[model samples]
Target: MTDVRILGTGAYVPERVVSNDEVAAAAGVDDAWITAKTGIRERRWAAGDQATSDLAAAAGRAALRSAGLTAEDLSVIVVATSTPDRPQPPTAAYVQQRLGATGAAAFDVNAVCSGTVFALSAAEGVLGRTGGHALVIGADVYSRILNRADRRTVILFGDGAGAVVLGASGGQGPRVRHVALHSFGDLSGLIEVPAGGSRMPVDETVLDEGLQYFTMDGRGVRDFVGDHLPRLVKGFLHDCGVTPDDIAHFVPHQANGVMLDSVFAGLDLPRATMHRTLTHYGNTGAASLPITLDSAARAGAFTPGDLILMAGFGGGMAAGFALVEW
Candidate 1:
C-alpha cells in the first residue's frame, strides 16, 4: 500500500484580532470569566468581505509552495468547512477556481470541527489510489454564523484556515500509519446550526428567531467528550499497535483551553506531549487541528522517527485519529 505522506503544511488567520475583553463586554461577561472558561485571550475575525474560500485558497497556495509544487500538480482539492461561501456550490469549487487548479476534482466535506480529519482520510485514500497529489484544506468562518450576543458560541469560535499536500511517500518525511474515524449521529443535536438546511430553510421567521446562528449545548458537549475522548484515544492507539509512551507528540483539536485541560487530565498521555493553541486562537472548528499541527511543525517540534498521534472530535458527533511517523 502506498501510504499517504504529508509533503508540506500552511495556515492562515485573518488580520482583525479580537480580544476577550471586547467579546466579554458584548456578552455581559467579564474578561476573566471568558478567559477562565475557554483559556482564550484573543482570536481573529475575518474581514467583512473575506469568506471561507479565500482563506482556503491562501493556505492552499502556501502549502503548495512549501511542497515545491504548483497548483497544476494537485490532482484533487478537498475542503472541509461548515461555513461555505454559498450553499449552492461546494466551497472547494471556489477554492479550486481561486487556485486555478484546472483539472482537479474539487469538493467539500462538512463534518463540522472534525472536518479536517474526515477530509484528510478521504484525501489520503484518493491520493493513494490515484497515485497523484491532493490538497486538503480545513477552513472555517465561524464568525459568520455566530450570534454575537450568545456568549456560549460567540466567545468560543474564531476564523482560520490550514492546508496540507498529500502524495505518495518516497521513503522520506512523515507518513500516515493508521487513521481511525468514527461518527455517532445520535448525539448530533448537541451542536448544530438549526436552520438553513433542507429540513429548515431560511425565512423571515427563522431570521427573527435567530435559528440560523450556531448553537451548542456546552455542558452536554463537555460531558460527551469526558465520556468518549479518552476511550477513543486509548482504543485508537491500541489498534495502531502503540501506547501513550510511544507517542512523541499529540495534536488534538484546539477546541478550547479549559476544555482541553479537562479532557487531557483524564487521558493517560503526558501533558507536555499535547500541542495546543487554543489560548490565542480559540476554537477554529475544522481549521483547529491543522492550524495547530502546522504551527508545531513549522516550529521544529517534530523530529525524524517520531510517532505523532493526532485526534479530532466535533459536530457530527464525529471523531478521528491518525498515527503518523515523522
Candidate 2:
C-alpha cells in the first residue's frame, strides 16, 4: 500500500475583520456577552466581491507554492464546502479553473464541517492509487448565508479557506497514519440551512420566513458534541494503536472556545497542546481544522517525530479524525 502524506498546508481568511462589537450589534447582544459565551473576539467576513471559490483558489495556490508544485502537478482537487458558489456545478470546478489545474480531476464533498477530513480521506485514497499529488481544500463563506439577527449562528461563523497538498511519502513532513469518519444521520436536524435545497427550494415564502439562513439548535449541538466527541476520540486513538498521552498536538474544529475547553478536558490528553485559531477566526465550518493546522505548521509547533491529532465535528451530525505522524 502506498503511503500518502501531507506535503504542505495553507490558509486564507478574508481581509475584512468583523469585530465582536459589530457582530454583537447585529445579533442584538453585547461584546462581553458574546465573548463570555463563545470566546470569539473577532472574525473575518468576505468582501462583497469574494466568494468561496476565490478563497479556495488562493489557499490552493499557497499550498501548491508551499509544496514547490504547480497546479499542473495536481492529479486531483477536492473542495469540502457547504456554502458553495452555486448548487449546480460543484465548487471544485470553479476552484480547478481558477487554479488552472486542468489535468486534475475535481469534485466537492459536503460533509458539512466534517467535510475537511472526509475530503482528506477521499483525496488520500485517490492518491494512493494514482501516484501523484492532490489538493484538498476546505472553504466556506458563511457570512453570506448567516442571518445577522440570529445570535445562535451569526456570531459563531466566519469566511475562510484552508488547503493541503498530499502526495506519496517523501520521507519528510507528516504522514497520515489513520483517518476515521462517522455520521449520525439521526441527529441531522441539529444544524442546517433549511431552504434552497431540493426539498425546500428557495422562493418568496422562504425568503420571508428567513428559511434560507443558517440555523442550529445550539443546545442540541452542544449536547451532541458532549455525548459523542470524547468517545469517538478515544476509539480513534485506540484504533490507531496510540493513547491520549502519545499525542503531542491536538487541532480540532474551531467551533466554540467554551465548548472546546469542555471537550478537551473530557478527552484526557494531558500531554497534548490544544491549538486554536477561533479566538479571531470564529468557527469557519470545514475550514477550521485545516486553517488551524496551517497556522500551527507555520509557527514551527511540531517536531519531526511528533504525533498530531486532528478532529472535526459539525452538522450532518458528523465527526472525522485523522492521526498524523509529524
lDDT of 1 by residue, 1-326 (tens): 57788899999999999999888877889889998888898999999999999999999998999888999998999999999999969999999999999989999999998899899889887877787899999999999998889999889999999999988755566888889999989999999999999999999999999999999999888888899999999999899998788888889888888888887777778633789887888899999988998999999998888898888898879898888898
lDDT of 2 by residue, 91-112 (tens): 9999999999999999999999
Local accuracy by lDDT, each model = 0.90, 0.94
- Evaluate model 1: give its TM-score: 0.98
| TM-score of predicted structure 2 | 0.99
> TM-score of each candidate?
0.98, 0.99
lDDT at position 77, candidate 2? 98
Candidate 1 lDDT trough over 10 residues, lowest sum: 263-272
- RMSD each, Å: 1.1, 0.8
Off by over 4 Å in 2: none
For candidate 1, the per-residue lDDT at 275 reads 90
